[model samples]
Target chain A: MEVALETNAVFVGIEYLAIFVWGLSGGLSAVRKRYDLFSILTCAWMTALGGGLVRDTLLGDLPPVGITDKGYILTCLASGLVVAVAHPEIMRLKWTMVAIDALGLGLFAVNGTAKALAFGSSGMTAVFLGMATALAGGLFRDLMVGEVPMIIRDKHLYAVPSLIGCILTVIVYKIVRAGTVGMQWEMALDVVIVAVVFVLRMVSVACNLTFPGAVDRGGGASS
Target chain B: MEVALETNAVFVGIEYLAIFVWGLSGGLSAVRKRYDLFSILTCAWMTALGGGLVRDTLLGDLPPVGITDKGYILTCLASGLVVAVAHPEIMRLKWTMVAIDALGLGLFAVNGTAKALAFGSSGMTAVFLGMATALAGGLFRDLMVGEVPMIIRDKHLYAVPSLIGCILTVIVYKIVRAGTVGMQWEMALDVVIVAVVFVLRMVSVACNLTFPGAVDRGGGASS
Candidate 1:
């Protein structure tokens, strides 16, 4: 029997929270870039939803849910509008933004990995897809704003945290399957993965950690 | 009755040519950016195949042919190696590169539009998908290297030609369906769309034509 990852009450709540945070981060990027309203809104929408769209597309899920979900669209728009109107004050709370971004990354990583498994993907594929989902939005936003993707540079442990979370997800999933664990155990493990990812990513961002012998090699390992 | 798009003998030839040229152009961009050999090869692969992957994903086609097909991958890699190793003279022939790029755009636009329709997309959706297919690879390459996408700037007739070709494809498809036209006529129309797109794009590049209102606000309009 195959296990299906249901978007339960907690999952749904976390998704909305993650989306809003993603939108806020996207708005911050737009403000920093000094983009006009149209571009700002677009950036918000894409950054909040583009990852899911790309993930679903790669999975051959037609008519991406991100495009069809009205709540997600409204959340992105609301965040974009708010940031456009009050960007100076919002930009000042840089740490707050980073904290929210870390949460978004963890949530997306765990959710994407679970979805991939539910879709019957192999463990490795699920891990790869999960990291891709976690990073897609930021990559899209960076590209649109004409900047090199930070993930590509291996800086600040961005993809690293997501990758670790995804790997852990795969491990937990296999254990649950092997032992016939209950849904409650699966949920607990999922939460643990998200927490681990959040802590790892947030610490790296706060400490300005960088990946060495990989990229940005000549620079100091810490800012 | 469903309409099927066949990648026939001529279409296959043009597609390979386009992929090779796209790879070469990507290699050129990598060299200009002073990227390492690995980066240059990755750039080439993305530029040559990214558009098709995006298009196929939109159409819910799994495992994009670009990735699954070894021949296509080899073509891109070979083209990248050649251009990366000997870019000085290749870079000098700017006009030649532009001409080939035009042809590639035309072929991709026509092919993508037909594929969308084959997958049961609406005519307008097909047109949109087609232009996106023509533009996606270039956009990916630009963003990867941290530059504004030229298509967004709208300085050239890049997207315009593709859009026209896509619309033409729709019209042809409708005619073929309504009149019960044979496969030969359908194939002929496909060729016509490609030719028209190629000619329009090439002429614009040669004449430095800029789309009015869309991008270049102040211009002679005729030029």
Candidate 2:
């Protein structure tokens, strides 16, 4: 029980970090569009919290922490304010942003999967929700800005890494429950899964790995 | 008690109609984009159920009816298939579609506000979620098709009508609860409110009513 409590603290810490990074990315999008202060802050909040909101909602978690939790809300808003004031050329910090984003992705995917499982969701549902928790924020951000969501448009490794992480988390969770694994071991495994997701994402980026395009766009029959 | 049960039946009937209309609209969008069968079906389902999903989640309703109810799922899928097979000239039936869509907007707004209040949400939050429940589906459909959401861009009388309906619903609900009004009277008022919303939306569209564009686009100092 003590180990579980400690692990929860670590989970929350990473979640906050992920939220802040995602918020910055969203704020940057608004800045690029030259939107007003209200729009910038709204975009940042949506990008940081949208995924978790969806995940929690699907898992039957009420009054999603995104809005109810003062800490998470403040972190997102502060991140937006920082970006609005700094207006840093994010491209210069592209690598750093990518790294943080990958961390956030892994954290969200693993944590989301675990939460879904705890809520009695099927494994398939858990995996999907986990990916949704990692990706929906960016999707909402893109929609707010009138852009096609990068996850859908880009053929990059973003979603694939999240998918892999969620699947592994579910597998590990099932094994831990079925075996005599201690809480500490389970917690360690969770961390390892997150790390693996991060590494896979980074490697994909470095290697320029991507999924293939649709076999034929506009070649199919109408309707 | 009998009146309350009858009113609930009426409410469910209207909700199903609203879902079907919204699904058709979403499927039409995907069809126009020449999306594949899978994409069309997905888009339809999203457009029909997305709003309710968001609303229910925010209101702490678990396992949203949109996903868990086989009836809702089948309705959405059937609507998609109909659109796919028929390839209806939606524009030629523009006025019909508008009327039906307006009906849906009113139904969703009123139902959403009522549900939020029942769930103990504040008046302001209830109003916001009500509008969200009416708008989110179309927003999701637009995002899926890579377009700027009409709700955000068109400035049409669409969202305003929903907002008005929700506000009115809340006020009436409060009055009914405060006074010694019978359930039958409250039910009548609900229907009246929906009609009012429908008429308002139709009138606005006929008059080409719209909110004004941003007062100052690109006027602010660089972030």
Candidate 3:
């Protein structure tokens, strides 16, 4: 029982850290849009919470953790507050934000996969859900700000990396279940997978990788 | 058999129109962000398809129509093409975009409710799904662009209006089934509900009657 509690604690802690980083990125983005402080905080909170909300709702949960848990909301609020207070200094260190954002992505990808598996979702569904959970928040942030989501178009490998990490996590879980490894080994596997994805994403951005040219098919598309 | 075919045609036609308008808004928004044409098209497609994708996936459907249907993809592509060509001129007439957006919202709200019912969802869940379908695309667009989602922070009554329209549609369907109303009356009810929502949205926008004020539960209060 204690072990289970500890595991839950570890996962929740990592999730909150990821949420903070995502909130920071969202706050900084809103600053670029010249939104007032209220709007900035609102955007930050939404970016931090939106993905988890969608995941939980789809999984038949209510009042998603991001909204129900004081800790999650507080973490986002604190992140936004700190960024708002230190905007000038933080804005100057663009690389710091990017690094944190990448780390958050890695953490979220792993966390989402683990969570889905814990909920008894199949491997394929777990992987897809993980990728969705990691990317959805950023997608929401971009849309709210009236910008195109980088994940869908840019070949910077954001979603791809998340997918890779999630697949690795699932494989590790299966192998460990076969008695080939232990809990510590599983943790190591997760770390390595996340690290690989983080490094790959950084390199992709550095190399300015992008999607291929467009094919124009004509007409008015509506949702 | 002819009646069923006619129903299918009407539903498909309205669905395509809804996708077109939603996609157009997304494409135009991407253009405003100065994204490349490929990125614009991607955003357009996501905005057009995102809500339906969510709705279908939650309903346990496979290979969502937005992904599997060539017609849907073509519609998105066409919307992007038109937006790319006409954006400069259209940028000046924000009201036109707003009107079309409202129309799309209403149509999708009704369509989403109908689809949810067809999928055997409960009335409450159907209404929720309907509002989600109507608003999710725009919400996704705003988030992708790093803007505050209009549904959350803006006082435009966007989601609320959709909810009302959806409920009205559901009630009409129920009445028709109870023999208190005919099929034509049910269809007319849908049109009336949509029109009411659309007009309400336009009036709200023009009057600038946004949500009253910020609720300060925690964090620093905004001015």
Best by DockQ: 2
Clashes of 3: 33
Per-residue lDDT over A163-214 for candidate 3, one digit per residue giving the tens place of the 0 to 100 score:
7888987898788878987766877677787788888778768888653322
Between prediction 2 and prediction 3, which has the larger DockQ? 2
lDDT of 1 by residue, B147-209 (tens): 778788758799999999999999889888788787669887788788898899888877888
Candidate whose lDDT is highest: 2
Shift of residue A179 alpha carbon in model 2, Å: 3.1
After TM-score superposition, the amount by which residue B222's alpha carbon in candidate 3 deviates from its true location, in angstroms, is 34
Residue A111's lDDT in candidate 2:
81
TM-score (all chains, Cα) for each model: 0.60, 0.60, 0.57
Each prediction's DockQ against the real complex: 0.12, 0.13, 0.11
Model 3 C-alpha lDDT per residue in residues B1-223, reported as the tens digit of each score: 1211126566568668768878888887777666556667767987998887777766765435555567887899898887877765555667877887788788888888888887788889888888878877877777766678867878677877788888987887788878986766766677788799898888888997665666777768853
Instruction: Locate the minimum summed-lDDT window of 10 residues in model 2 chain B.
Output: B212-221
Give the native contact fraction of candidate 2.
0.19
- Grade the docking of candidate 2: incorrect
Full-model lDDT, candidate 1: 0.79
